[model samples]
Target: MPLSAALLQTLHSIVGDKGFTTNQGEIAPYLQESRNRFQGHCDILIRPKNTQEVAEVLAICNDENIPVVPQGGNTGHCGGAVPQGGILLNLSRLNKIRQLDGLNATITVDAGCILQNVQLTADKADLYFPLSLAAEGSCQIGGNLATNAGGIHVLRYGNMRDLTLGLEVVLPDGQIWDGLRALRKDNTGYDLKHLFIGSEGTLGVITGAVLKLFPKPKARACAFVASESPGHLMDVFAYMRDYFGEQLCAFEMMPRFGLDLVLKHITGTTDPFAIAYQWYGVLEISTSRPNTNLQTELEEALHPLFDRGYIQNAVVAQDLMQAEKIWALRESMSEAQKREGGSVKHDISVPVSHIPDFLAETSHAVCNVVPGSRICAFGHVGDGNIHFNISQPETMEKAAFLTNWEALNEIVHEMAEKYEGSFSAEHGVGQLKINEMDRFRGGVELDSMRLIKRAFDPNNIMNPGKVVKI
Candidate 1:
């Protein structure tokens, strides 16, 4: 259904001429997320300033039976931020750090605040906000929470859902529900905030949030180690857990192809090792306690593995700069791959023990399905999440390579399912994975999800045709 003139006038009047724009040129950038797979179209773009304004805009849209797609930094890979049609609600102006309670170790912020800016603000107050990702500089808190983002720090602080305490949302009917209580333990009947955390805006539009903070780490040690296989990495994780315990901050895995791409594409990025290894794992240990000897503990734990031939080589960062340099090589992987060619990326997770089997089996299956495809699998090994991405064969045309994406996804997902792994891990099921969700997610789970969707957004106006199909 098309939006009526009266409703457009109401939306325009609420946001003012400066905020409302129907210009395709102006709205072009917001149509697609970082992945560039799912593109959106909108009747008009709405930029509401505050919670009240957001609620009013939503209310008017709701009355007119218009769908509303809430967009933040537009940096999402899952296509959750892209609008289907109707109104595109831009939350960039809602950027405000409402409060920073140092005593309680909590910070309340608007949905539009860029993730890196949030980290910086927390750092200024001598605290740590542990949700660090490559898109932190551009991705907004609302998008992060919407996707329940799991980044480099999931080994320590956990995902966006765990880090968040409360959320302020504008419901389908334009009513505001303020659950912004900064409580660590709340014995409430139902934890409603969890509903919107990773709903991908299907439930409601997240406007503001109260997030947990941590004491800043005083010391850190990082290393890039060569693992014989994913199993060897698991063994290393056990060793780190047995020794460093809570200090083991991150454990990331990298396939040989992923590392090679980064070193080849990104100038100045070098391989930490002289010889190419089948698998590599980057582990970091951080401590808030001053004078903690984390580096010594890491070396001690690796001594046995080094002797046993489980790990081929290892280089521990001696200083902060060196640590960042080593991390830069790992972090540049995705961007470097993008520069190289079209990539079919999957953010999937399996059990820690099954990671080895999943990797080996999925690699074999995907390559067999699409021969010459390069498997560049890597991600947070601590949480068992693998960014199992497939790179186009160097000889193949971009269009021809991308034509096999769905087939490649099938091969990867089949093996993942065999390991009892998720089809979509960190990235939410936006428009891109709706079909995957229909196939993979069970009837009971889908029914429950639909029930919640119906409860909050019965009219199907809030991010319609996303997460689940009605």
Candidate 2:
């Protein structure tokens, strides 16, 4: 059904003329996600300035039965931000750091604040907001909260879910749920804020949040080492944790192919060591106090493995710029692969013990299904989350490569089930993964999700046809 002129006029009035745009050229950018894989067509794009404006927009849309898609920086890998022929309610204009309570170690920020900005704000106060990602420069805090984003820090700080103390949300029917209390121990009830954190805009729109902060690290060191397998990496991880439990900040894994793609496409990059091994592990250690030698700590912890040949070679970054150079190689994997060809990406997780089996089996299955396919599997190895991505064979056509998406996804997702892993790890189940969810999610689980959707959004006016397809 087409929206009435009066309803569109009301929405335009709430956000003002400058805030609304119907031009296809202007709306086209906001309609698609980062990967350019999922595209949506929206009738209007509304840039709301504050929580009250967001509530007003939702109120009008809800009354008129007009669906609304809440979007942030629009850097999501999943189609979580794409609209479904409705209004694209962008929160970028709502960029504001409401408060920074140094005593409490909490920062209250508006949804649209860039994630890196938030981190920088905390850094100025001798604090840290440990949600580090490759897209932090472009992604927003609301999107991070929406997807419950996990990055390299999950090994020590956990994901976005653990970093967030509370949230302020605009509900489906235009009511505000002010659950933004920054108390550490509030086991008061059902923990409703969590439901909206990873809900992906199905239940409501996130307006603001109170995020947790940590002490800034004074000593830090990064190392690139070669491990024989996940098992050997696991042993190394266990050894490090025994001595530097919380200090071991990040543990990332990269297959040889992933490293090759990075070296091939990204300039100013080189091998960290003299020898190129089949598998590589990037590890970092940090401490909040000064006068600590992280390099010495890592060297001591890894001496046994170094002697036993479990690790082939290692390079420790001498300075901050060198540390960043080492990390740049890891961060450029996705884009480097994109330069090669189309990619099929799966963000999944398995038991810490079963990562090797999952990788070996899934690699074998995908290769058998599509011969000559290049696999670039790399991600946070500490939490067992692997971004299992495959590039089309160099000789194949892009159109023909996408045709095998379903077959490849089936093989990988089935193995995820066998290992008792999640098909959708940090990336939520947007429209792109609904069919996969239907295959994996139990009937009762789906029914309960539906019940909640019906309870919160009876008319289904909030991002309709996303995340379980209400």
Candidate 3:
């Protein structure tokens, strides 16, 4: 149902003319999702200036039983940010670095603060906010907290869910829950902040967050290593981690197919290795101590793996520019896939030990199902999260290839389930994986989630029909 005239006017009043918009042109960007898989419609987009304004909007929304989709930078892979109806609560105006406690190693910021801005602020303070993703430049910290986003540094610093210390949220009934305590340890009742973080705004709108910060790394070593086969990455990663330990930040894998896709499609990319290899991976080690010879450490550690015939060829980035160039190959996976054609992607996780076998088996299975289907498998192998993306067969029609989405999802997700891995890893369930909740996740686990959703959002006015169903 369309919002009543009075209700719309009230929402407009809640946020001044500058903060509210009914025009389709201005509202179009909010509806155009990151993946472009879904485009949502909202008659009005409300941009609240502060937590009080957000609470006021929610009070009106809850009373009218209006569905509100809380949106951040709208750079999420899942369509969780996209609203079905009701006015969208655009939190971009709330962007502000509220506080930065360098001594305590915490930074408090409004939810609308762009992730890169926070990172830049942390850098200025000689500290680090390690939750780094490709869309950091555009994505917001609130959405990151809401989705519990995981990026390359998850192996070291943990996901946004782990990095966050506290959250201030507006409840479904318009009550502002100020739980933003920047404490390392607080045994004060149940941790309510967790309910909103990674909740995908189904329960409440994340207004602000107190995020944990880490010591700035003085030096980071990067390398692009080639494995004889996909199966060898497990042994290779083990050798590197055993040597580097907590200093190891990331270990990402991209197949030759994925590399070729980037080379063929993207500009200014070069082949780091002299010969083409079947499987390629980028491993990084970071340390806070200054003048640490990470290159010498890498050389000493690589000799053993090289002698064992596990490593095919490798090149450590000589400088900052070279390091970024090496890292670019990994970051360009998604963009290159888009340039190629339709991609059916999976952000799933298995045991670190099972990654090699997982890639080999799943890739073979998918290719068999759809002949000529190019597999562009890559992502954070250090923590077992693989972005197993399958590009449509070049010869096949895009529409026809897309029809196999369910079939392909079944093949990939089923194998992940069989391997005791999660079907949805970093990317939350959102609308895309809602059905998978029943198929992969069931019984008591799902029951508890539903009960909590009903408890916090009894009316289900907050981000309805996204993560869970009643």
Candidate 4:
């Protein structure tokens, strides 16, 4: 149903003419997600300037029983931000850095602040905010916390949930829950901030956040390693973890096919070795203490792996430029896959020990289902998260190959369950994996989620048709 003129008039009064737009041309960008998998329509796109304005908008929407979709950056892999109807609430205008407490090592900022701007803010203070991702340039901090984003540095720093100290959210009923306490330990009650951290905007609008920061690393080292197989790479990872301890910042794995894709499509990237190997690993170690000679230590660590034949070859980057070149190959995996053809992507995780068997078995299963499919698997091996993507065969049509998306996902997700793993690892369950929630999640676990959804959003006005369905 279209929003009534009276309700629209009231909403317009709360946020002036600049905050609301009904023009389709101005609203076109917010209607589609990055993947183009989900396209949405909205009666109006409201950009609230502050928390009070957001509360007022939500209060009116709730009173009218209108569906509201809160969008942040719109960079999510899942379709969480895509609106089904009613109003689309975008938090882009609420961009502000509220505070920076050096003594407490926390920085407070509004939801719409771009992620890269936050990182740069911390850098200027000689502190670090480690929630880094490829979309940091445009992705908002609210979206990062909403999705509980994980990136390369998760091996050392942890995800957005761990990095967050507190949040300022406007509840579904227009009540502002100012739980933005920047403390190291707060045992006052149930950690309410946690409830909204990974909720994907179903509960409330995350207006502001207080996040933890760390001392910037002064010493760094990087290496590109080659191994015969995934098993050997795992062995190398385990050894590095034990050797480097907390200094091991990132340990990423890449298959030979994935590297070839990057070299072929992405310019200025050359293979790190003279001869290609079956599998590869990118290792990074850093310390906040200056002049730590991490490169020499990393070089010494590789000698033992070569002796055990776990690594066929290795190259330790001697300078900052060389290290960045090595990391670029790992970062370019996803874009390169797109250049090939249609890709059926899966973000999955299992026990770090089970990755080798999981890959071997899942690869066989996928090929059997779609013969000639190219399996391009790579991700954070240290954290056990693998992006298992399948490219269509050269002879097959892209649309025809994508028709197997559901079948292929079922096969891979079933395998992940067999190994006692999660179907949605870091990517939150938006509209894409709602069915998987019904399939893999059930009993008290799922029931409790639905109960919380009903309790928090009784009107079902907050991000309707997302996360949990009541």
Residue 301, candidate 1: Cα error in Å is 2.8
RMSD of each: 1.3, 1.2, 1.0, 0.8
Off by over 4 Å in 2: none
lDDT of 1 by residue, 1-470 (tens): 77777877888888898789888999998897787787789879998889988999888778778888988998877788888788899999989999999999999999999999999999999999999898889889999999999999898789999999999998989899999999999998899899999998888899999999999998899988998788888888778767778888899988888888898899888888888898888999998889987777777778888987779899998888889988998899999899889889998999888988888888888888778889888998799899999999888888999999889888888788889999888988888788887788969999888898999988899988888988
Give the per-residue lDDT digits (tens) of candidate 3, residues 370-404: 99999887889889998989999989988899999
Against the true structure, what is each candidate's TM-score? 0.97, 0.98, 0.98, 0.99
The total of clashing pairs for model 4 equals 0
RMSD of 4: 0.8
Clashing pairs in 4: none
Clash-forming residue pairs, model 2: none
Q: Candidate 4: where are CA atoms >4 Å away?
A: none
Angstrom error of the Cα, residue 308, model 4: value is 0.6
Worst 10 residues of 4 by lDDT: 1-10
| Residue 408, candidate 4: C-alpha displacement in angstroms | 0.4
How well is each residue in 1-470 modelled by candidate 2, as lDDT tens digits?
A: 77788877888888897789888899998887788888889879999888988999998888878889999888887788898788899999989999999999999999999999999999999999999988899899999999999999999999989998999999977899998898999999799988998989999999999999999999998988888776777777777777788898898889889999999999999888777788888899999999998887777777788987778778888889989988988999999999988879999999878888899889999999999888888888789898999999989998899899989888888988899998988888888788876788859998899999999999998888888766
Pairing residues by index, what is the TM-score of model 2?
0.98
In candidate 1, which residue ranges exceed 4 Å CA deviation?
A: none
Query: Cα deviation in Å at residue 167, candidate 3?
Result: 0.7
The deviation in Å at residue 104 for candidate 2 is: 0.6
